[model samples]
Target: MKIFVLFAFAAFAVVVFSGRSEVSQANGRYSTGSIDAPTGVRSTVNLYATKVGVYWDTVRGATLYRIYRNTANDANTATDVGTSAGNYYFDLTAVAGQSYFYWVRAENSVTSSSFSEPASGRRANGNVFPGPFPPLDPPPSPSGNSVTAAKASLGKALFWDEQLSSTNTVACGTCHRPEAGGRDPRTLFGDLASRNPGPDGTPDTFDDIFGSPGVPKNNADGTYFDSPLFAYRPQVTKRRAPSYLNTGYSPNGLFWDGRATGEFRDPLTNEVLIAAGASLESQVLGPPVSDIEMAHGGRDWTQVAAKIAAVRPLMLAEDVPGSLRNWIGGRSYPELFEEAFGTPEVTPARIAMAIATHERQLFSDQTPLDRWGASIEQLTPQEMNGLSLFVNKRCIDCHTGSLLADNEFHNIGVRPQLEDRGRGAISNNPVDDGAFKTPTLRNVELRGPYMRNGQFQ
Candidate 1:
C-alpha cells in the first residue's frame, strides 16, 4: 500500500509540472497588447523664430513616438517629420507667418497605435526671412521692367545720343563712361571753381553738396563746357560716380545718399507714374534733367524726346559698335521708334524704359569668385585664404548676399569736413546721419577710385 502511494504522488507531480510548461508556451515568452495612442497632444512655439515644440501625455506602454507634420489641417497630407522616445518633440524647420499641424502616434515593439488628435502652432510675426540671391542667368525681367531685344536696341542708341544734352555734347555715355568703369573720368563736375558756396560762402558746411562739386558752369553761349582748363583749383566731386554694371539688381533707391528713390512719379503731375519695381526706370529719368549730368536747367522730357526724335540716331557718336550700327541701319529716329514701339511716337517713359532694358543686359557675373561658386573652377589657396579673412574680419556682415552687397545702410565713420549727411538727407532721421547704402563688390577690381567721395585708392 505504501509503494502504491509513492508512485501515484510521482505521477501527479509530473503531470502538474508538464501542464505548467504548456501554459507558458501557449502565452508566448514576452508579449503585450497594442500600444495606446498618445493623448492631450498640444503644440507651442518657443522664443526661437523657426522652432515648433510638440508635447503629449505619455502612453502606458509606448517605447517611442512618431511625430507627423502637415502644412494643412488634413491628415491625408501628413508626413512623419521625425521620431522621439520622450513625450516632447521639437521641430526646427518651422517658418514664421506659417501655421504647422502635427499629430503623434505611440509606437512599441508589438504595434503602433492610432495617431493622436492634430495640434497646431504658429511662429510669431516680424521674423525677416532671407531671400535668394542673384540667379545664374540674367533676370529676363524685373518686377515692373520687362526686357526685349528691340527695346534694348533703342535704349542703346538713346544712351549714347549726345542730343539728350543741351549743348549736344554730353550723353548718358559721357558721365556713365563705359570705358571708365561706367562712370565719368572727370574729377569735378566740369572745371575748377565749381564748389557750392555754403551759407557762409565757405568750402565746408551742412548745405554743401554731398558728392558733387557743383552744377556744371554754362559758357557765355549758355552751353556747358565739356572740359576747360580752369585757372583756379576746382572743387572735386562730393562723391564719385557709381558704376552701372549689375546695378539693375538694386530693387530700391539709387545714388550714394539714396535720394533718387525707386518710386516712379510724373514730373508734370504728382501721380505715381509706373508700376511697382520701376526703380531703374525712375532713376533713368532723374539724371537727364539734373544740371550736372546731361541737361541744362528747365530742360523737360518733352524737349529731350523731341530733340532725339528729330535728329538721326547716334549722329554725334564718334564710333558705334557694328551690332549697334546694324540695329540702326541708317534709319531715322522715327523709323527706329516704329520698330521698337508699335508707333513712331517717342515718349520720355519709352526712353527711360529702353535705357533701363539695355542697362539690365550689362551683367557682370563671370568673375573668378562667381566661377568658384559654379564649381567650374577651383579658387587658388591664396584667394580662399583672402575670402576666409574677409568673413573673419566681419566685412561680410554688410557685404553679404550674392551681389556681395547687403543693400542696407551703415555709418562707417567716413565723414568728410563738409559732413555730407547720406540717408539722413533722404529720411530726415538723425539716426541715419552719415549712413550710406552698401555698394556691390562684384567687379571691384575693375572699379577703382573707390569710396563715396573717391577718397581711397
Candidate 2:
C-alpha cells in the first residue's frame, strides 16, 4: 500500500514538470519565472566643451540602461534622457555653465531596477571651471583696458620711464624691480618707521602706527627733503612693494589697503573711463604722482603726462633686455602713442591704460605647485606633506579660490585695531578696523619681505 502511494506521487510530479515544459515550448521562450533585479549600478558624468559624457557600471541582466538628468539635487523631477546598451550615454543638450545632476537605472524586457547614486557635474572650460569653487563662465578675459600688442608695448616703455617721476631718477621699475619678482630690492630704511594715514590723512595717530614704515617725509611743496636726523639715510618707503606677478588676475582692488579701488576715474579730469572692473587701471594712476613713492606730493597727473609726452620712452633704463628694447626701443613716446591709441597723444587715461595692459602680461603659473595642481608633474613627499598640512590646518580657507586669494578682508590677529585701520578707512566699519586682504601665495617664496609693513622678513 505504501509503494502504491509513492508511485502515484511520483506520477503527479512528472505531469506537473511536463506541463511546464510544454508551455515553454509553445511560447518558444524559457521564462526564469521572474528576472532578478539588476544590482551594483554606478554612474559618472564628465563635463566637456560641447557635451557631457556619462557612463555607468554594467548590470548582469540589463539589456539597456536609462539615464535620468536633473538640474537640481532633487531627483523627483528628473527626466529620462535616453537609454544605452553598453552603460554609457553622451548628453548633447548639456548647457554650458549650468550645474547638472545625473543618475542611471538598468532596464530589461521584464523589469527595471532602482537608480544608482546621483552625480553632479558642470560644463565649462576646465581652465576656468576649477573645482572647490564655482564655474567661471565667459571665462576670465582682459578688461576693457585689456592688453593688446601695441598697448602692452607702450605700457612696458612707460613702466621703465624715469621721467614719469618728479626726481627724474625714480621710475616704476625703481621699486618694482622685474628681476626681483617685481618687488623692491632695497630695505630702504632697515626696518624704518611709518604709519597709515588716519581719517584726516595724517599718519600721526595711534591707529596708524602699525602700517608701512617711514616713507621719506615730503616737503610742503611735494619735494624730497633731506631728513633732519640723517641726510645719508636712503629714502624710506611707507610700505613694502608687492610683487606684480599674477596681479592681472585680481578683479576688485589693488594695494594692501585696496585704496586703488575699482572706480576708473581719469586722474586729470576725474571723468569715469572704464567705470568699473579696472582695478589695475586705477592702481597705475597712483604711484606716478604719489609724493613719497614716485613723484612730488602735489604733482598732478597733468605734469606727469607732460613729462612723459615730451621725453623719450625708457631713455634711462640701461638694464632693459635687448629683446624688449628691440620691440619698443626705437619709437619716440609720441610715435608709440600713435601706434597704440590711433593718435600721438599721451593723456593720463592713455598712460594708465598702457601701464595696466603691460602689467597684465607679468603672470607666473609655472611654479612647482602650479604644475602639480595642473597635473603636469608630481610633488615630492616633503611638498606633499606640507600641502597636506596646509589643508589640514585650514590655511586654504582664506588663501583659496582660483587666484589663491580670498581678496576679502580678515583680521587674523596680526595687529590691534588701534594699530592699523586697514579696510576700516575705506569701509568705515569698526569690525573691519584691522582687517587686511589676504595676499596670494603663488611664487611667494621669490617675493619676500612679506607683509604690508615688511615685518615678516
Candidate 3:
C-alpha cells in the first residue's frame, strides 16, 4: 500500500511540472520565461515645465516599458499613463505645481512583469526665490514718448486692429498674445509648415528652425504672390518670436539679434525720432512695412500711415476689452490719433511712440515668486531645491537681477554657429556667432517652444 501511494504522488508531480512548462511556452515568442520587473525606478520634475520624467533600470529582455502614474503612493491604484521602448518616459500631461507618484513595468511579447516600486516627484511651482526681491529700475522711455493714458489707449487699439495689416487679417497682437506670455502660439505646432530651414536651406535637418508665420507674400498692387519657399502660404521668420513680456525692463536693444537698437530712426526721412532708450520704438516700426510680416512688397511708411488714416480704430477686432471699448465710444481713427498725439495726423513716429507707451504698461511683477518675496506666500520643498540648483548651477550668471535676465547675448550652442549668426549678423562680428539674447524667465512656463530656434518645448 505504501509503494502504491509513492508512485501516485510521483505521477501527480510530473503532471503539475508538465502543465507549468506548457503554460510558459503558450506564447511562442517567449518560450523561455516571463519578463522581469524593472528596478531602480526614479522620477524627476520640471526638467521641462509641468513634465514628470520617470526612469528605471532596463530589464534584459524588455521589448517595451509601461509607465504608470498616480496621485497617491499606492502602486496598485496607479493607472498606465504611457509606454516607451526605452527606459525613460516624460509625462507631459502632468499638472504644474502638483505631486505625482510613478511606477514602471517591463513587458515582452508574452507578458508584463510586476509593477516597480513607487517613486514620487513634483513639478516646481516656480514660486521660490532665494532672497528678497530687488528694487526694480524705472523702465526706459524715449525723451518725447512718456507713457500717457491717451497715447496708450490709442496704441492698444492699433495693436489689436487687424486692419493695420494689408490683408486685414494680422495684427501685432496676433503673434504676441497675452495668454501665451507674449509669444507666437503657432510655433507650438511642431510641424513642417511652421519650420524654417536654417542657413542650410534644407527641411527636416538638424538646423531646422521653429518660427512664427507672418503674412503671405503680396505684390505691390495688393495681389498675392507665390513664394519660392512657402508657395502661397505665409512667410515665416528665421528665428522664433521673442516674448514681448517684461521687454519694458530691457535696458539695451530688443529682438533676438538686437537689430532694433536704442536709437529710433525714421524709416523714410532719415531723421532721428527717439535718440536714446527707444529700443521699443525701433522694434515696433519694423513689422508694419516688412513684406514678410504685415505689408505688401515695397510698402513704405506713407502707405501704412495712409491706411491707418482711412480705417476705423480696431474695426476688425472682436470681444474688445470693456475698458478700451468704453474709452473708444464710437470714435474714428483720426479722433483717436488727435487725442493721442495732440493732432489728427498718424505719422510713423506717433505710431511707434503710442505703441511703445502701451507696451510699457505690460509689467508682470505680481507672480507667485513676487508674492513669496513679499512674505505673502511660501514655496514647496521641491521648489526650494530647484532654487538651490538654479544658483549652484550658475544659471544666475547669465540670468541675473529682478528681471531674471542680464539683457545680454549668449551662445549656449542650441545649434552650430553657422546655422544662425544671431547677434553676429547684427554686430558684424565673428565672436558673436550663434549668440542670441537672454530672454526673461518671468512667465516662462507660458512661453513654450523655448530658445531662439524654438527647438525645446
Best by TM-score: 3
Candidate 2 similarity to native, TM-score: 0.64
Residue 176 miss distance in model 2 (angstroms): 1.7
Poorest 10 consecutive residues of model 1 by lDDT?
19-28
Models sorted by TM-score, best on top = 3, 2, 1
Candidate 2: 10-residue stretch with minimal lDDT = 18-27
**Which candidate, 1 or 3, would have the higher TM-score against the true structure?**
3
> Per-residue lDDT of 122-168 in model 3, one digit per residue for the tens?
65444333552442333655687775545766777888888888888
Q: Locate the minimum summed-lDDT window of 10 residues in model 3.
A: 17-26
Each prediction's TM-score against the native? Answer: 0.62, 0.64, 0.70
Per-residue alpha-carbon lDDT of model 1 for 1-457, expressed as tens digits? Answer: 4333322221111111111111000001112766556666778643234456676654544557799988888777798889875445668677765788999887767888887889897654433234322212343455545554456667777888887776676677766654455655653432234334333444454333323333454542565555342222222344677877666767657787776566666665657766555666777887677655556667788877888788989887876755466546677888766755658887787788778776766655434444344333455655655555666666678766667788788889865422767888888898888888898766554454566755454
Q: Taking the tens digit of each residue's C-alpha lDDT, what string does model 2 give over 178-260?
A: 55556766643233333334333454443232222223545435455665432523344545677675677666588877878
Q: Return the clash pairs for model 3, or none.
A: none
Per-candidate local distance difference test? 0.60, 0.59, 0.71
Which residue pairs clash within candidate 1? 192-234, 211-238, 211-239, 212-238
Please identify model 3 stretches exceeding 4 Å from their true place: 1-138
* Cα displacement (Å) at residue 109, model 1: 70
